[model samples]
Target chain A: MLTGHRTWIYNNQPVIISTGTVGGPFEANGNIPDAFDILHDDMWLKQSSFEKAQRTMMEEAAQIAIKNSLIQKEQVKFFISGDLINQITPSNFAAKTLDIPYFGLFSACATSMESLALSAFIINGDGADYILSGTASHNAATEKQFRYPTEYGGQKPPTAQWTVTGAGCALVAKNGEGPRVTSATIGKVVDMGITDAFNMGAAMAPAAVDTIETHLRERNVDPTYYDLIITGDLGHIGREVSMDLLQKKNIDIPEEMYRDCGLTIYREGQPVLSGASGTASSAVGTYGHFLKLIKEQQVNRILVVATGSLHSPLSVQQNDSIPCIAHAVSIESGSDNQ
Target chain B: MIFFWAFVVGGTICVIGQILFDVFKLNPGVTLTIFVIAGAILDGLGLYDPLIDFAGAGASVPITNFGNQLVHGAMQEAEQHGIIGVVTGIFEVTSAGISAAIIFGVIGAIIFKPKG
Candidate 1:
């Protein structure tokens, strides 16, 4: 709903652009550029070419995470990822080229955090030292799989997510100096199946922020305990409603202290009307922008919860609303060293 | 005979695009861009012109049809000029459409007291 806090994060980077909408407008635009890498789950691989899309999105996600992580090609040690597709093409491709001994896992949107949680566990369990986890989703791909085509021109309300057309990547290591995955309290899928896809973002946004609140409670940290925390791609309306709800729970979150991935994902007035959603919205912002902030000592502790709306065609046909789930992954940059 | 289906199908596609605008509340430009790109891809794969030839203006007036026009115009230019065909590109291929949008946008801006 607002664009004020972004300046503090990027020193006022000119990344997000807004389109002028008429009054009575309550939606955020989610458009990014062509050259800007997207988290599209399918990468527009067409109906029969889904496998290729999966590979492209996953590899694209991994390459991005690796680049932002600044880890050598072989230093990744392990790859973790997941998706809604058969055999997890995104995760497969994320692991294929780097040859870091891939470990694929899927809990949908929560996979971002799930991967982080597992990576932290491995670091804690004496498995691999450095782990990279990510997830990617495409509007075209997800629309084809879950809804209609870009050609369908179906009505989408503000509540629905704009299925982020990109991937999100994260790198977790056993540094122990930065805010570690201190502890995580995961939430179950609370989808009551409100199948209207347009409003799905609104539905999912609450679950995500709530999980964040819970994660903070479990860690025994206050809302301001960490400098900044970011939520996955909840569009304009969802972001506003989530903050309102958080404040109701007495979580004093300054607008600057928290950010939404969708709000930061695009350059507006292009094509994508929402900010950014898919796996990429958070992936790029977190790994690219979020990690950069963490390293700069701008903020020490951060909590991130990648959210997913677990709506299936089967559930929609049953007159159900799209169900949403959120997974929390707590991360902190340890003293800017590790 | 084929024109009948062209009129029905192409008109339906246009109506869908419009409804997407009116009911779905999507902007016309974005809707146009998506369909036009889709039309270009379909034409590159060789599956759109016959319908256009059939529907005539029905397929030609809307933004999706404009995209088809661009693709076909490009293909025609490509054959005649070989590699240099796309050099002129938007000006040669989509001059009228681009001019129309610019002209209309300016006119809309001028005619309506715009406020951001």
Candidate 2:
């Protein structure tokens, strides 16, 4: 039900039954590598092109989710997925391979939670029995489309973020044995007139803050309700910027309780300038990493606020400022019926 | 024979770039820039023409050819118009590609949604 201005309360409490995560060599070498279901030794997973490689990752993740759930592909009623590639071809092609009814999504990097929220909405409303939702990105493919090709040798500023190479998928059902989706806060597009593509963290942070604030107020709860509040790919600069903004808004989230997927995905010495940013940034972190923590009882209740910067090569060249968005989903450890 | 040589030479150049990127772990951007600069220098020294003759489209199809063209244009104009040509002649050859990039980029932005 629509709870407030931008929040929805999933009264039926759809459950995420299983998840599949695939990561590249970079993520394999980074933090939480064990969280991934399949870790590729190379970025190109036997695909001739990086874009195809991204599609392979997406397909693999969906397959893994289905397999882990002990369900046949035919059992899945719908597939909602997306990627950072032009026109979101990766997800569409993956859907062709999966052959399930598809919903191609494009919220840039925030696609993970966007798909998740929609899947929950459908299942909660009795529209489908089971839904597969996912998002993926390849570092080289994303860089080639949005900026220069990796072979271009163009120097990127320190503010630039490395697009992650991975995919995350989850199987959501009306009744299942896993983490429950309690609430979701949809974000509005907020452009602060920042035009520099290199500084996406700064470009996306305001939208994240706006969504978080709305989620808190609408739920009639404070930051303490969640054991951890995670934001999508805000990296270092955006993380700090959001924290300051939250404090100014009288939202007191402890540093220990607040984290960013972008900062957590990679190790310190990795060449990611600011931090990681891509569809996979939050996907693998939440689906593969944090969900395991919740299942293990390491984390109880968490809020994942996935952020995305909606800008393309065309938008950047057109001198249009970056417009960003964030989508928040509240996940609890136990089933709502419990 | 010409197509064979073009394929071989082009493949070899690509192999070198691949080695630089995969084995040496060099950034792709840096590797590409190095190839472009190396091509321009080879053309400036008058050593690239033989390779162009030997490989045909192989030598000209990649970014190295673009660099060679820039030097070639600048040198021809410099001989006739002196130092001013050094500044303006390179653009005479490369302007088509650059302007096309910009024009298409703007058109694409205006026509399509940014994030979809």
Candidate 3:
């Protein structure tokens, strides 16, 4: 049911039965290496192009999710996914290979939560018994499209973010023994006139704050309600800015309770400038790392706000300021687990 | 005949880059920088001119050509205006591309709206 403006409260909580995460060599060495089901030694993954490798990563993630769920591919009712590439080619090609009823989405890095929320909505509405939702991104493929090609040797500014080369998929079902999607809050497009593409965290931070504040207000819940509140791809700058903004509004969320996926995925001394930002930033972190924690009974309830900078190469090249969006999904651990 | 030579030369250069990327696991940035510097060093030694003569556009159009142009500009200015011109003249040859990118980027940013 549509509740509290942009928020949707699911009366029939859809469960995330299983998840699959795939990462490249860089991610394999990063903080959440254990979260990945498969890790490739090279970015190419034996494919001729980085784009093809990304497609394979997404396909493998979907297959892994299905396998973990103990279900056949034919039993999955729908596949909803997206990527950072132009036209989301990786997701499209992967969908082709999966041969399931597919829905292609483009929400920049926020696609992970966007796809998951939609899949949960469908399941709660009795639209489908089982669905696959996920997002993927490749560093090389993303760099070639959004900035200079990897071969260019162009020095990026300190604020520039590293696009993650990874994919994550979750299999959502009507009934399961896992975290349940309780509600979702859709975001509004907010543009702060930030023109620098390298500093996307600043550009998208406002949108994330907007959605987060709205989600709390609509539900009449305080920020302390969730055990953890996470945001997607809000690197250092965005995270700091969001904290300041939230504080100004008297929404004092403790630092321990709030974390950004971009900040959590990588450790210090890594070459990632501002931090990680991509479709897989939130996807892999949530599906692989946080879900495992929930299964271990370490966390009870959580809120994930996926932030996306909605800008294309054409838009950036044309000197347009990035418009950003964020979507928030609430998840709770199974009562049976306790 | 000239088109065939151009295609072959360009294709070979691209293949070399691909091989470096695949075999050495070199990032595209490092590989491109190596090619450009290699072109500049060859040009300084008066070897790249012959390759340009033989390959025509193939030698002059790739990123290696940017290095060649930089060295060529610096060398010419050094002959005319001593040491100071060397630094200033490097931009003389590359200013067109840089300025066009900046100016056009600014104009585009002002005109377009970011969508999706």
Candidate 4:
């Protein structure tokens, strides 16, 4: 590794939304809708079960990983997974058919990296053989839990991200010089009790900033040491608020060096009522794109920060405050693969 | 030169919209709102129909259409009800969005008996 760390190996694969559900229209590429509608239906059908929707994505992620790695299911050791569900049925379902030990986690959308972090730790600890850490989040499920159902069609603020309809899973290895999960900076839930539910991106921004700062501090690593710093889907508003707030703290990370997964993954205006944020937004993008970048050695030392807004609709409905959390995981790309 | 000027001016305006997106951190919907508000304000003073003539969907698709509908509704309601008439009231002078929300909200409460 360029930074004297265990290098992580990555194989980036593009996620074609062929076999998955799209909440709304996924404006194709930067400027084109798909040349033709490939969905079973001409229009996006809203599913009733969050688990059903989440599974559609998790399975897609697993299939992609299988194809990319060309590894069999039996080859994987422990499958560590989590999701924003009743008992994380999506991850459990993903694991049920797999040939591995499954450990499911729940920390809202932060579950992805929380799973990845622990996976890295276990791999480094040498207690586990080979593992796959994954998480799936559903847009409809998150909204029903945190805000309203799609049928509700409530007036959405521009800052809100439409929960992305996708899942992201990563295969972690203890051997064969794959991309190794380096240092994981765990984050505590930050509760500011900001009451404007419509502008949650702003509310969650402070927590993300705090976590990033804490992660760097705890690891005693500088921002310059990493080639790119990525954040989970915070959408347009959260991204702005996060960058402005971070710069004020004297963290001079430029806009280019940092990519907001929420903004990067979705079409600029595909009519995301809340904006772009669902478990799938980060999942597909990180698994599909960022992993590709890592494989290409486009950026070596990368810090992946996934943010979660831990507010359920019940809490909001009952006039309780929103608690947000962000987890940071460092994955160093292995030069040997390149 | 004149056609070139037209293309330059038209393209520059769209480019400015993109700049507002990239650098100024404006959401498409919010920026759309601003454009519509500006158009509506101008149209209120009888000045923007020509812009509509020049730029069809660009001017019409925004919130300016909302304003136009509200203005039309108010004028029609005002005319029909006369000075003594309170057609749909001032708050609901535009569309049934407010009226339906209040009336249907009460109906839903009665029917559903929602839990606290």
Candidate 5:
């Protein structure tokens, strides 16, 4: 049901039965290697192009999710997925391989939570029993499409973020024994007139803050409601900026209770500059790391706010400012049915 | 000695580009555009010819040389055929490089796929 403005209260509480996460060599060497179900040493995954490799990762993630669940591939009714590639071709191709009824979404990097929210909404209303919600991103493919050729020797700015080469998928079902999807807050497009293509962290900070503030307001809860309020791919600068903004707004989210998926995925000195940014940053971080913590009863609840910068290469060339958005989903430890 | 100077001159030019990128915070595309324009201006002022004589391939091999060639060809043609030659000859000397790049680009697309 629609709770306050822009917020959906999942009264039926759809559960995430299982998750599948796949990472590339860079992620396998990162801070949360244990979280990934499969790690590929080769970025190509023996594929000819980076785009095809990305599609393979998405396929693997979806297959793994289904395999881990109690249901078979035929029982999985729908696949809702997206990616950062041009026209989201990686996701479309992955959907073709999965051969399920598909809905390809695009909210830039916020695709993960956006898909999850939609899946929960559908399941809450008895639209489908089993839905796959996930996203994938390839570093080389994203860099090639958004900036330059992979071989081009371009020095990125300090505020620039590294795109994760990975995928994360969760199997959401009407009845399951896993984390419960309680509520979701959809964010509006927020542009702060930042024109630098290299400084995405600064460009995306306001959108993250807006969604976070609105989520708290609409839910009628304080910052301490969730064990952690995790922002998707905000990285170092955006995280800090959003924290300051929250403080100024009197939201009073304690520093320790707030975390960023971008900062959590890679350790210090990984040459990730401002840290990770991509659809996979939040998807992998949430499914691979935080969900494990929930399963172990280490953290009870988490509010994942995935932020996305919705600007194309053409928009940047045309000197148009970046429009950003965020989507927040609250996941508790277990379902009432469980 | 000639090779040594060429290396030094070329390295110096690259270092200047690095400074523009790091210190001035110009992106690669903008930095490269500035270099090309600077080369044309220097050649127009009769300064780049002497540097080319001193540095050989170092001065000629850098992307700045493309701008120098454009100005050089345009001026020579302007002297012989009046105003319209300036427009006609601007691309004459740089045509080989552009054509080669197109041909090689197509071949590369056909033969090679992008690696991760």
Candidate 6:
């Protein structure tokens, strides 16, 4: 049911039955190496191109999600996925491989939650019995498309974020026992006229803050309602900026309680300047790490606000400011069905 | 002594590019353009030739050299063929480098796929 203008309260509470997270060597050496279901030492994953590697990762993630669940591949009614590649070709090729009814989405990094929220809404509305929602990104592929070539020796600033080389997928079913999707808040495109493509965290922070504030207000819940309110791919700068913005708005989410997926994925001194950013940053962080914590009862509720910077290389080169968006999804442990 | 100067000069130029990128927040494309323009202007002022004589390959190896070559070719042809030679001579000295880049790029594309 529609809770407010852009928020959706999943009355049926579709459950995320199983998830599959895959990472490259860089992420395998990250903070949550064990979180990923599959960790490939090779960035190419034996593929000729980085795009093909990305597709392979997505396919592997989806297959792992299905394999982990009780359902078969045929039981999955739809596949909703996306990536940061041009035309989102990695996801398109993966969809072809999965051979499921596909709904290719593009909200940049926010695609993870966008797909999840939509999957939950579909299952809640009896649109499908099983839906696979996921996203992927390849470091070299994203760099080649958005910034420079992979081998380009240009120095990136401290504010620059590393594009995650990974994919994460979740199998959501109408009836299952896992983390339940309670609510979702879709964000608006918020631009503060930031043109520097390197500082995406700053460009995307306002949108994340806007979505989180709106989600809290529209859902009639306090910031403390969820044990943790996580933002997607808002590295160090963005995380700090959004936190300050939240405080200014009198939304008091404690520092420990408010975390960013970008910061949580990699270890310190990993050379990921600000932190990790990509469609998979939030996907893998949430599905791989936080969900395990939720299942282990280390954490109860989480509000994943996946942030996205929606700017093309052409748009950036044309001197267009980045327009960013964030999508928030509330996940609670399935033990408490109430 | 020549090799030492070349190393120092080339390293200094690279350091300037790095500062432009890291401190001034200029992108690689912009930084390279600035270097090229600076090279052309220095060549126009007849300042780059002495530096090239002193530093040899160091002064002539960077992207700045491309700009110097462009202006140098244009000026030489302008003396002989007047105004129209300016446009015609721009690519004269740098054609080998550009052509090699294209040829090698195509060959690389054919021979090898991008590594991760």
- The candidate maximizing TM-score is 6
Give the worst 10-residue stretch by lDDT in candidate 1 chain A: A16-25
Stretches of candidate 3 off by over 4 Å are A336-338, B1-116
Model 5 residue A18 CA deviation (Å) reads 0.4
Sort the predicted structures by TM-score, highest score first.
6, 5, 2, 3, 4, 1
Give stretches of model 1 more than 4 Å off: A1-51, A60-77, A93-101, A152-155, A158-160, A175-181, A268-271, A336-338, B1-116
Report the lDDT tens digits of candidate 1 across residue range B1-116: 76686678767987888687667655445677789887778777777777677777666665666666677777787888887785555356678778988899889767863110
> What does DockQ give for each predicted structure?
0.02, 0.04, 0.03, 0.03, 0.44, 0.47
What is the DockQ of the complex in model 4? 0.03
Which candidate ranks first by lDDT, i.e. highest? 6
lDDT per residue, candidate 2, A108-153, as tens digits?
9999999999999999999998999999999989988988777555
Q: What local lDDT score does residue B53 receive in model 5, on the 0 to 100 scale? A: 93
| Model 5 lDDT tens row, A1-338 | 89789999999899999999999999988999999999999989999789999999999999999999889999989999998889999999999999999999999999999999999999999999999999999999999889987767578878899999999999999997999999999999999999887888888889988998898888889889889999899888998889888878888988998999999989887989999999999999999999999999998989999999999999998889999999999999983334
Which stretches of candidate 6 lie above 4 Å from their native place? B1-12, B22-24, B54-58, B78-88, B99-115
TM-score, model 6, chain B versus true chain B: 0.97
Q: Which residue pairs clash within candidate 6?
A: none
The second chain of candidate 4 has a TM-score of: 0.44
Model 3 lDDT tens row, B8-69: 98788888888876666454568889988988998999988888888899888888887888
Sequence-dependent TM-score of model 1:
0.61
lDDT of 3 by residue, A212-232 (tens): 999999988999989899999
- For each candidate, what is the lDDT? 0.61, 0.90, 0.89, 0.63, 0.92, 0.94
Two-chain DockQ for model 3: 0.03
- Estimate, for each residue in A162-207, the C-alpha lDDT of model 1 and write its tens digit: 5554555556665423344554457667664444565656778778
Tens digit per residue, CA lDDT, model 4, A174-259 = 55544546676777788887766666777778888988887676566788888888888777788888899898998878788888
Candidate 6 or 3, higher DockQ: 6
